[model samples]
Target chain A: MAIRQLSVFLENKKGSLSEITNLLAEAKVDLRSMCIAETSNYGIVRIIANDPAKALEILIASGFAAQIRPVTAFAVPDQPGGLAQVLEILEENGINIEYMYALVTTIADKAYAVMRTDDEEKTEAVLAKNNIELLDEKNV
Target chain B: MENRKYYQPEFETMPVEDIKKLQSEKLIKQVKHVYENVPFYRARMDEKGVKPEDIKGIEDLYKLPFVEKSDLRDNYPYGMLAKPLADCVRIQSTSGTTGKRVIAYYTQYDIDLWEDCCARALVAAGADKEDVVQVSYGYGLFTGGPGLNGGSHKVGCLTLPMSSGNTERQLQFMTDLKATVLCCTPSYAAYLGESLKEMGYTPETIPLKAGIFGAEPWTSENRRQLEATLGIKAYDIYGLTEISGPGVSFECAEQGGMHINEDHFVAEIINPETGEPLPEGEKGELVFTCLDKEAFPMLRYRTRDICVLSRKPCSCGRTFIRMSKPMGRSDDMMIIRGVNVFPSQIEAVLLKEGYTPNYQIKLSRVNNNDTFDVFVELPPEQFDDSVKSISAKEASLRDAMRNMLGIGPAIHLVPPKTITRSEGKAVRIIDERKLHD
Candidate 1:
């Protein structure tokens, strides 16, 4: 299964970030996780929300260049080398992660990471082969 | 030094009193001629309650109605021509954005006078019969090429009618022929400098010593860049196809302002909104009245360019009135990169492509080059669910947009409302480029 993420194109202009959040706030859309990658003139805002469809609808209605992207979310031990362990598996399987961010979960010493890969299915297969607990849409 | 400076010493250094006398005489003659020959102009004068007898000279110029870009469109081809068809020898027109282009008729004498003005520009830049002149402005229909091509002939320079584009071939000729003078737009000069360096030719190896650049707006920043890169002195020439093309006025060695050929054309600064003449040095819309042009003489024609005029003493000893580089345009039209672009043109493109007109154009200068980006709002039904499909749609839209606009603007297919709800003013353009003051 795949978790949905919103990748938005934004010029590195003042208040563009707030414009996105303000619209989401008005629609009462809860943000699950988010990350922003920026260049000198432009930026890409990646976001995860509780209701992707409703959030996308509200964002698109406001006139943003927003789109949905399929990504993988999985449980990772929050201790030392937790990130390293997942990276080592992907590295061994020759999979490259485009970008990623994390969600703060309530479980002790455990957190969820959402990542995009070039080859989605192959990356998921290698992670699942190593007994990683992958979170689907319902769990997310 | 005096002989080297003025291409035509008599008019260029004429006393202010005599210059005024000539202007008044020409204005009187041109007015009566237009009234008798061109009914279109006569009707406009009549509508404004003005007659040819009422206009004595440049002072009475304000009494005449102003002609604009749209007026040319209304008249189309030869509707506004002041001379007979048999008398006209040539025609040149600007590539208009919407429907009909603004056409300018030229007689053999008109072309001669135009070349004389260009010759004055070249001589002002320190060129003479001994120098090799290469004209790279596009030929035919476009005035830049022919104006300078004819002017180079008048100056008796070994003329190279290279025309525009074919940059590699341009370099080969520049070096092979040892061309010492170049005439082109400032942007094309910059591009040529870029390509020349990329081809591993140093400025010293190229024989170009001076450049006469016009047909587009350029900044002091652009001037500095081109001068440094091309290793040549850059001069500005100003004109419009409606008012006899690129040689109406030109920069002298003083580099303060371009000297308008006041002997052949009367230059005025008028309030763009009110059509009232502004005092000298106050920036306003530029107006021109052809004093010597016979075929397509325009009276009080508004250029839409915002600029100021000065009569200060010049080191070059030319008494012709000077006009500052046009600061900006009064209309919605803007020069993007090197091409003229209008927001209305882009809006029309969007409508023609079945897209709503909700869009934003962003311009920025990154590392001395312009980056044009347009963000268009997609309809809710076209809500792309996948990145691949969305990118594919964007690519196709980009092709259509590039076809509409001369250059391809980076297209951003944004959601329906993300671009609009943010800006309170609904401002269509966001320019981040730092321009030369």
Candidate 2:
């Protein structure tokens, strides 16, 4: 299944990530997984949160450029090569992942990985065919 | 192209006394024209307790309050117009890299005189009707392309309005049309030169006889490289969008300094600190007063180009006063930790340290403190993306920059070609502090 994620544009200055996280915490929004892609001047912080709309509102109100994007989230075994198994499915299916991040659920004891791809529908179908367990907003 | 030294010989070779006489008459008239028409200029003049009568000749240029870049921004679109909107035929503007683009209006007459200046520049570069001129300066709100395009036609050259980019097509035209004169920024000219060699064409294979480069500050060593690479006489043309672009002054065969068009625009050098006019041959901020323009005539506008001026006689027989190549701009100086820094100084350090000149400076304000960082591109052979390797390179560059800039800068070692290439003006600085605006 697909989960909503927040992508915030932040300048490459100290405490920028902290500012975003602190803003989210102030809004009582719990983050699922986070990853950052950066260049020389600025960075894009991609984060899956429990309430994507609330998190995005907090960031935008704080003068940050933030947007919500649907990302595929799936759970794998909490062991080595857990990512390789899911990645092999996409690779064999000719699905390209733009970026991805992973985190292990404390209660479920299963590692969860969030992925953004060019073809979201294809990525979802391929992951399902590989017998991967997907997570929706409720599961997250 | 057959050699044609001067376009309008009378304007080009006018005696110093005659040039001054023409300038004085135009200055007195322009001052009155701006005061009566432009409310912005009138208010500024009124605020300074000065009148049009106070300005008689170029000597009184110092009495007028200086017009800074902010004035144009404050007055946005048509606030600075000195002519009726109906009479204005064209407009050119700045790139608005830092802030809003400053739009400059031009009447038909204004465009004519501007083109005349460019034609004169073309003649100085040995362009004639027999030549094929390929103008590569980016055309649009930018003044480089249109200014030279008109000039090329006025000179009766077979004009190729190629504008900028599309290197493959540019080379195709250059070879097919046998363009004898090239007009573009020095950076793009260098890229063309590099591409030509990569395509297996040597200087001997190229038919270019001359090139006119401007818009961005370039080094003397760069001029030499362009000359050697393209097998052409590289000339420097100076102008700003505020005061009729790309033909305000031009280098002739002498190549010592650019000869300012004293008839169309009056030139003055003033101490950046005190705004007092300096004697000829003293380095200071270059200022200008539009004498011939009918629309958007700026009076005593501070150009911020750091350079010197002289009236030395030239082998080209033009008696117009010449301006030394601009060293850097006073406005371009960055204040970091109470220390003044210029990006050119950093560029000099990078060049000396055997690195490509591709670099970017990012200034940000975090936690109420200014953070200055220089992102330099590493050549392919030396590029190491690892933390330890990049940190080491950054350390070395920081030390060198600290020695040159007095205050140390946080250096970021980026991979080669990460910094964007500029076609019009190379954007070397990005102040993130302005992001809020």
Candidate 3:
């Protein structure tokens, strides 16, 4: 099973990243994994944290103009076709992936893949029924 | 009406010999007073092996070393005061935005001379006793406020001492007072003009006849916008706090250029690099010699403003030498990637493209190399199309900047009114390279 994630809009300017991190730091939220999808002007800061609800609240209070959307994360074998299997399942479930990127992992032979899809719940069911493992704090 | 006639003469029409003789007399007295009273001046003159008696006329001014803004800063609060502290009736200082504030001392006589200069500038700009003048320059340590206040009073205009910052109140006062002439920075004038339009007030109903703008170097594009928006003739008033605020010179109704107050202050263009004087009509550094100032007499003070001087008689019948609008400061020139770039050059490019000149340049170092980025505020009309228009505008700006600055800068177009709008001085450049840990 995969856990839901959120994508936040970040302005690409000085002190922007520090401002967001400071907000999350104040809220006592630890980011498990994060990545920045950046263009020249603005960026989308996606993060998987210990507490998503609290992170969303802190972001809103800081006037970040962010949005909470469900993204699927899958833990797979760090071998060939590990990510391929997960994408094939999502394709069969009629789900379109806008973008996806990998997260850092502690285990040498295992990695987690984060993906943005059309339907989070449907994608979560497909991954669970297909025996695809979703990585959480305990798994890491 | 009788008082108005006393103030209406064109000083430029006077013979060059008469102006030269007047300047020489004033220069001799000013040099003697500074040498005797101001310790800094006395010490500097002694070190140079020059005496007050050596400076017989304006031609001998080269004997003095040029004073600069840093010299004023070194003196700080009271070291530069030529008169005793008790005799000093007024004091003004620079904003100290870059470093320590430079405080200027003025006695009753100094104040009177400053007002006279401003009054001369106003008279040259076609202001008369019947004109209701609204002064919107920032007051206090900043010279723009009090300088114009005294000048307008001397010109016998019904002066409105509305110092800058509050635009809404300024508009209300302008409309209510039916002010015929306004004094302020050119940028503020444009902002006020835009605000008035937003409030549904047409330019014709504003009752403004003319404006005198200065304190910062503004381009002709800004002047045209201010003139069009206010539906009034906009004139450039040139002066620095070091020289005595916005009354050192002014443009006439013909709008050719600003005429220096040759009788009170001697203007010279000098090669900035070589420190040698340049001929008229050539662009170089401006150095002013205060001929009549008593309390704080500055001799050949080097003003880093890069401009050209022309001695041709203006259409307004003033024979005073005219200085073009300054292009950039010699000190403020930014050398990026071996190419010299100026903020004013970027300003010209943006204004030509129909964008607000409200932008900030951020210079940083990445990968051990210099990087430049421009953050600009998008206009309201382009807000809805921000995502699409900003990208296109960014591409165009990158190309334009490359052509002008010789380097392509990453342009970031933000939403409307996002950048801070300063009521006083606008901060347009940020060099992050200096902030390295």
Candidate 4:
């Protein structure tokens, strides 16, 4: 299943990230997972927050460029080959993964992976056909 | 209804000869008025070996020495006043740095005439007593607000004195009052149009029927955008605080160019370098000679605006000569590698290429060569997650800008809200070469 993720535009300025984190912290929004893609002049901080709608509201209200987007998140077994099987399924389906990151969850003996694929619907369909468990906002 | 089509039709539709005659008579008196009352004008005239009698009429307008902005600054607050301080009722200054602002004094009569000019603009934009005029130009020291506010009253329209910003309140009052006319800068109008769309209000749902936008340089493309967005006929009103503010000229339905109020202000195009008057239709710096101003009379004042003037009769029945939308201010023109590049030109290209007008121009001299760079915000709606995609967008914008500017510039697509804006205006130019110099 797909869950909402926050994509924030950050200018390449020192203390800008700190400013963003401080704003979210003051609002009591917990960051569950995050990854950053950087260019020479700017960066995009992708975040999966426990309360993504709240985090987005605060970030945008505080004048940070932010948006809500859908990305697929799924739980995999803790074993090393668990993540490989998911990648193998995606590679076989010819669906390209744009970016992927790990999600912080409390479920024991299980790891969560968040991914943005070129064809999100096809990726989730393939994952469901492969009998992999999908994660929604409720669980992750 | 027929009379409502033209405000002050006697003057607006005056014959060319009569208009020129009226100007000559006013100029003769104004020249004498400034010479006898203000020492600054008299000294400048004496230095040039010219007398008030030398300015016999419009033909001898060149006989008067042109007054530059520095002359006004040199004379500061009270040095340029032709009327006594006790007689003057109001003061309006240019929106410049505070250290040496060019303060313009206005008598009650001057304010009435100024409001009449603004009323003429409103009427030209199809405004009347039945209309509700919403003025969004900033008030206090800035002439846009007060100028239009008084004009709306003169036209007998229910005026909403919404002096810029407070977009939420602006929209509320606009809907509640059913404002039929909007007055503000073109950029602010665009923002309002966008906000209306965001609030799910379409052009059909809004009551605005016309807009009079001025005080900043905007392209014809921008006019088209505003017209479509607001579903109204967008008109251009041209004026400067030095010349009694927004109603020196106005656009009629034809929308070819703005008609100069020749009865009060005599306009001439002159070679900026040599001060020789250019023939009609030639692009040059605009000069004005205030014919009827009483408190702070100006004689052949150099306006530093580059534009062309034409006498082709307009269908609007106005005999006043028309001046094209100014190309750009003379001082605002940048010579990058011997090529003149104006921020307006860059802005036109940006708007044509589907970009917002919020952009910053960065210019620096690197190792004896001018390095021109333009920073444009990649609006959040157009933001992409992939860096390559954004870089491609920047490359295309750079190519388009080079095609228009005749000089290539490095274009950086930064995130939205990165550029600094004061009072809803983007600081467009940053010339670092001045720092090194």
- For model 3, how does the per-residue alpha-carbon lDDT over A1-140 read when each residue is reduced to its tens digit? 45545445556778877877888898898887787866766766778777878888777666555556566777875679878888888888799886787876676666777777767778878888998887654553
Write model 1 residue lDDT over A1-140, tens digit each, in one string: 88888867665779988888888888898887888876554566888888888888887677666778789999985578988999999999899887778865455666899888888899889989998888887777
- Residues forming the 10-long window of minimal summed lDDT in candidate 4 chain B: B93-102
Residues forming the 10-long window of minimal summed lDDT in candidate 2 chain A: A102-111
The all-Cα superposition gives candidate 2 an RMSD in Å to the true structure of 12.5
Q: Could you arrange the candidates by TM-score from highest to lowest?
A: 1, 2, 3, 4
Model 3 spans with C-alpha error above 4 angstroms: A1-140, B1-13, B333-437
Could you tell me which 10 consecutive residues in candidate 2 chain B have the lowest summed lDDT?
A: B380-389
- The candidate that achieves the highest DockQ relative to the unseen native structure: 4
Q: What is the lDDT of residue B404 in candidate 3?
A: 60
Better of 2 and 4 by lDDT: 4
Candidates 1 onward: DockQ, in order:
0.14, 0.04, 0.07, 0.28
lDDT of each: 0.84, 0.82, 0.75, 0.86
Q: For model 2, how does the per-residue alpha-carbon lDDT over B13-72 read when each residue is reduced to its tens digit? A: 999999988898998999899889989989999999999999887777788888887788
- Better by DockQ, candidate 4 or 2: 4
Best by lDDT: 4
Clash counts per candidate, in order, are 10, 0, 1, 0
What C-alpha RMSD separates each model from the true structure? 7.0, 12.5, 14.7, 16.3
Interface RMSD of each: 5.0, 11.2, 6.5, 1.7
What would the per-residue lDDT of candidate 4 be over residues A14-115, giving only the tens digit for each residue?
987888889889999988888988888888888888888999888767766678888999988668688888999999999988888888887777778898
